[model samples]
Target: MKLRVENFGPISYADVEIKPLTVLIGKNNAGKSMLAQLIFTLMTLTEGYIPRRFLTSMLQHIRTTEDFIAPYLRQVDDLRKKIKEAREITHLSCVKMVVDMIIEYLTQYLNKTLGDFLERYFAMELKSLVNLYSDYTRVECAYSKYSIAEFTITKDGNLSAKFDIKMMDELIDNILKDEETNKLINRVIRSRGGRDFTSTIAAIEKIAEFIFPKRPLLSTLYIPAGRAGLLEGYEAVSSALIALASTAPLKGISVPPIPGMAYEFYSLLLQLTGRKGPFEKMSDLFKEVIEGEIVFEELKLPKSKMVYRFKFKDKESSVDLIHAASMVKELSPIYLVLRELVDKGYLLIIEEPESHLHPAAQVKLMEIFAQLVNEGLEILITTHSDILLRKLAHLVMEGLTGGRANANLKPEDVAVYLLKPDEKGYVTREVNILEEMPTFDEVIEQLYEEERNLCYLSLQREMNEASPRNF
Candidate 1:
C-alpha cells in the first residue's frame, strides 16, 4: 500500500510506498511519529472489525422483527396485527405460511437497514479521522480496494467530507446475501420461544463479520516510546482507576474521561499480564537477547479485589518487572506480543527498539527483526540509531552472498526513508541502497570534514610555537 501525506503536522509533502520492512530514520521531532500514527489510525478505522459495542447494542435492543420492521409495517396495521397473532400458532403448515409472508414483507426493509448502517459507519470513521488530525485543513486517504475519502475544514471551522458509496453498495451485495437474512429471521423466531439466545447471537455475529471483515493481513500493534514510563506506573494507576470506577456507581461520583491512546496502551499492558496463550515458547533470539521470561502473578484481596503483577523469571529467581533491568522492561512488551498475540502476517510499529539498550543488544535486536520479516511479519520502525541501520546493512550483504543462516531478507525487501526539515517544511526522501549498503555518505562526509578542520588547526598552532614572535 502507498500513503501520501501533504500539509500534515510538520510534513509539507511525503509519498511513501510501504514495503515489507520499512524504516524511517531522522532526527527527533522530524514528523516520523506523526506519519506512523496517521497510517495506524487510517488502517484501523478503515479495515478493522465492527465495533463490539455497536453490534451488541443492535442485537439487544433490536431483537424482535417488530423493532426494525415497525416503521415499514406502520401503514399495514391489520397485517402487523395478524403477524403478531400468528406468533401463538402451533401447526407446522400455518406457521410456515406466516413466516413466508413475514420474510416477503421484510426483504426490502432488511436491505435498506443494512445499507444505511454501512453508510453511517463509513461516515463516522471519516469524522474520527478529521478529529484525530485537526491541525491539517485538508486530508485524503485511499485504500487499495476502497475509494478515496477526503476531508476539508474551512476557515469557519466547518468540515466537509467527500466519499463514494458505490463501492460500499457493491461490497454489501457480495458479502451479505438473502440466505443470511433468512437465517436471521429464523434465529429471531427461535429467540421468541423462550430458548437460550446463544444461537441467535451467533447468527448476528456472523452477519456482522461478513459486513465488516476482519483485517487478516494488516493487523497492527503500536509500541510507543513512552512504554517504559507507562509500564512503571501501570499497575498502581490502573488499580486506582478501577477501584474508583467500581465505586462511582454506588457513590454517585463522576468518572473522568481517559485519553484514547492511554486507554489502548493500558489495555495492551493488561493483556500481556493476563494469561498464557497457545504461543508460549519463546524464540531463541528472544531468549538470547532478554535472558529471561515474563511471568504474571495474581493477588487476591478481602473484598474480592484481584490485582495482577508482572515479573521477570530466570533460572535463579524472579523479580518485579518495575525493578528489573531497563532493557527488560523496554523489550518485555514486544516479547509478550510476539509470543502470545501475533502468529503471522502482522504490522508492528515500534518507535525506537534501541531505547535503553546497549549497542550490541541493539544490533542483536535488528538481527531478530530480520528473522521476523523472513517469517512473514512486516515491521515499521522509526529510529535514530546508526548501529541498527549498519546491522541491517550487514544482514542484506549476508543475504546477497547466501552466507547468513535463516537470512531471508534481500535488498529489495527493505525501504529506508530519511526525514529532514528545510526552510519550507519537513520532507521525506527515499535513501538508495547500493551494493547491499545504505548510502549514508552525507553523514560520513560531515564527520570527515570536522576531523580535517581539527587537524589543520593543530598544525597551525605548532608552527606558531616554533616561529619567533613579531612583537
Candidate 2:
C-alpha cells in the first residue's frame, strides 16, 4: 500500500505513492523527518498506541510531559474556535451535534491533549476511521492543512514560533466534515510530545491495534543513533520497539534469540556481495537444519555499554522473527535483515536508517533496499540523505535491466518521495521523485563541473592552457 499527503506540513498539496519499497530523500530540514514522523504516527495510531513518546526522544527541546501536551492544546484551541463559529444549524443535526459533542467533550479537559485526557475522545477518533470505512467504503479525506509554526530556540531557553495556514487548508471547515480528517488530526495531535495534552492516547493505541491486521515480526533489527551513553540513547528504541512488540508477542520462540551459525553465514554472504546466498550452490548449510543458534546478545550488568548482535545463515534463512539486534548496530541488520524479511512477505518501517553511517554506507544501504524489492519485502524508510537518492536511481535502473528483475516489482514500487516546505512552512511530502530527475544535458554539465572542481583541487589545470572543449 502507498501513502499520500496533501497540504500537510511543509507542503502545499502533493501526491505521492509508495509501492512496496519507498524511499524519502531530501536535504536536511527539508521535511524528510517530518514526513517519516507523520507516517510513523499514523502507523502507530492505526495500530492504536501512543506515539508522541517516540518523537520526543528524537527531537531536541521536545522532551517531557508538557512539551508533548503544548502542541495538542494549540491544535485543540484552533479546532474549538472553528467549531464555535460553525454555520447556523439546529443542535440536533448529526453534523452540528457531533461538532458540539466534540467541543463539550473537549472542554472537560481544557488545556489538555484530548487524546491523553479523555479515553472516550481517543476511542472516538479511532471509531471515526474504522466507522468511516464501515459506513462509507469510498470515503476521501482532506487535511486541515494547518500551518506549522517556524520554531526557534531563544538564547534564554524559550521557543519563538510563527504560523500561516491560509494557503494550507483551502477550507478548514471542509476538513472537519471529511471522515479521514479526524484520523489525520488524531495522528498529529498524538504525535511526539503530544500525549501529555491528551489522556486518551492509550485508548487510541487500543483502536489501532484492533483495526489494522498486524504484519508478523519478520527478521529485523532495531537500532538507535548514539547520542549519549548506550543506556541513555537505547531506551528510546527499546521503548518504541517494545511498544510495537507488545502487539505481536513472541510465543514459541524467546522474545529475542541469537542467530544460529547458519543465520550468521547467511547474513555475511549478503554483506560481502550485496546479494544473498548461493549457499545451495556452494555449501551444505542449505540442506541441514542448523540448530541451537542464539540470535540475541544479552545486556549484561553495567549494561550502559552493552550493544546487541545477531545473524542469519545462507540459503536457509526465511522470514521468521527468530533474530534480534540492538539499537546501536541498526544499519548492519536493517539492510541485510530486511531483504530476507521482504522476500518472505514482511513489512518493515525503519526510522532514520541512515543515521550515524558514512555517505558510502548510506548509498550501499539503498542498493540493499533495491535487492529487497527484487525479493519482495514491503519496505518503507524515512531518511534525509541525498546519496541514498542517487543510489536509488542507480538501482532502479539496474532493476529495469538485470538478473535482479522480478515480475512482481515496479520502479514505482521503489520510489523516492520528497517532503518539502510549503507557504505555511508546515511539512508536506511528495513521491514519484525519479520522474523529477535532472535532464541528460543537466547531468552532463554537473559531471563536467565536478571534474573541473577536481582538477582545481589537484592543481592539475594549467593557467596557460585553455580548458578542454565541451562536447
Candidate 3:
C-alpha cells in the first residue's frame, strides 16, 4: 500500500511507498503516530467490516467524567435554592407545604431539563434529594441579608434577578439542613463518585468519529521481550485462534476445540521425553479435549520419539490446526500472530517492536519481515531504536546480495525515509531511503573509519596539553 498524507499534523505532505517491511525512522514529534492511525483507519475501511456511521456518531459525543460531574453538582445547587426560597420569609404555610412546593418545582425542572427519564437521557446515575425529602428529621431555610443585584416580579409575575454566587451558597446551605435529605444527597454523591461513563463513552465515540467503514475494535497489545521466559506457551495456541478469527478469509473459523487443546497432545508426547518444558504438566483433567490427528513431523520434534507412533494412528487432523508451536515458538503470541498476518499479505502497522527484545532478536525480526515480503505481506512500522534501523539497512544490503534471485527488482527496492522539523513547526524530510538508497555497509564503514581517525587526533591533542613540562 502507498501512503500520501497532506495537512495531517506535522506532516504537511508525505508520499511514501510501503514494502513488505517498511521502517519509518525519525526524531520525536515527527508524525509517526499520525501515520500509524492513518494506516489503521485505512485497514478498517479496506476490510469492509467496519461501519462509517458509528465513527461519526461517536466523535459527536466525546465527554469526560468531569463534564458530567460539574453539571450534576450545579443542578443539585439549583434544586437546593428553590427549596430554600419557598421555606424562608415567603409566608409559605408549613415546612411540609414548602417541601411539597419544592418537590413540584424540582420534578418540573427534572422533567424539563432531564427530559422525562433522567437515567436514560443522562447516561449516568442521578440521585435527587427531593425524592427522599419526606424522611428528613428537620427542614430549615436561611436567607442572606445583603442584596447586591435586584429584579422585580410585577403583578403579572414577570421576574428576573442578577446571578449571585454568595446568595446561591447561602440558599444551598439552608436547604441542606434537612438531615435525612442531606444524608441521602451525600450518599448519592459519594456512591456516584468517580463516574467514568462519560469518559468511556467519549473514548468509544472518538473511535467511531473517523470516516470508518465499520465498528472494528481498536486496541493495543504490549509484548515484554525482556522477559520471554515468563511467556506462557499455551498463549501461542490461543493467539493463533485469535488471528484466524480476525482474518477476513478465516473469519468464521472458531477454535472448534476451545484454546489450550494442544496441552493434552503435548502432555502425551511429554511422557515419552521424561522431562517436560515446565508448562507441559498443566494438561491434566482436559476431558473436553477434541479428538483429532496431529502430524508430529510437521512440529519439527525429534523423529526418534515414541510419539511418532501416535502420529500414524489418526482419523481427523483437528489438533494439528491448533498446534502453533511450529509456526510461533520463541516470539510472543502477539508478535507471532501479527507476523502471520504480515506474512499473509495483511497491512500491519507496528509501534515500537524494539521494546524488551535482544539486539539479535531485533535483527532476526527484520529477517522475518523480509520473509513475509517473500510471502506477499505489506508492513509499515515506526521505530525509535537505532539498532532496528541498522538491522533494516543490513537486510536491504542482503536483499541486494541476492541480486537476480528476485525476478521483479534490484538492491534499491527498499526505501528509507527521515522526517525533520521545519521552521513552521511542521515536519519535512531531507533524505528518503525510498527515493535514494541509503549508504550500504561499505559507505558506512568508510564513514566510521574517518570519524575514528578524527577522534584519535583529538585525544592526542588533549594529552599534549596535559603534560606538566609543556606548561
Best by lDDT: 1
lDDT of each: 0.61, 0.40, 0.39
Position 176, candidate 2: lDDT:
51
Candidate No. with top TM-score: 1
Q: Candidate 1, which segments miss by more than 4 Å at Cα?
A: 47-136, 145-147, 153-214, 248-259, 278-284, 298-314, 435-444, 459-471
What's the lDDT of the predicted structure labeled candidate 3? 0.39
For residues 6-73, write the lDDT of model 2, one tens digit per residue: 33334433344545776665555555544454343333322211233433333455556665455444
Candidate 1 lDDT at 217 equals: 36
| Model 3 ranges with Cα > 4 A deviation | 49-334, 338-343, 401-413, 428-471
For residues 341-363, what per-residue lDDT tens digits would candidate 1 score against the true structure?
76566788888888988998999
Q: Is candidate 2 or candidate 3 better by TM-score?
A: 2
**Residue pairs in steric clash, candidate 1?**
none
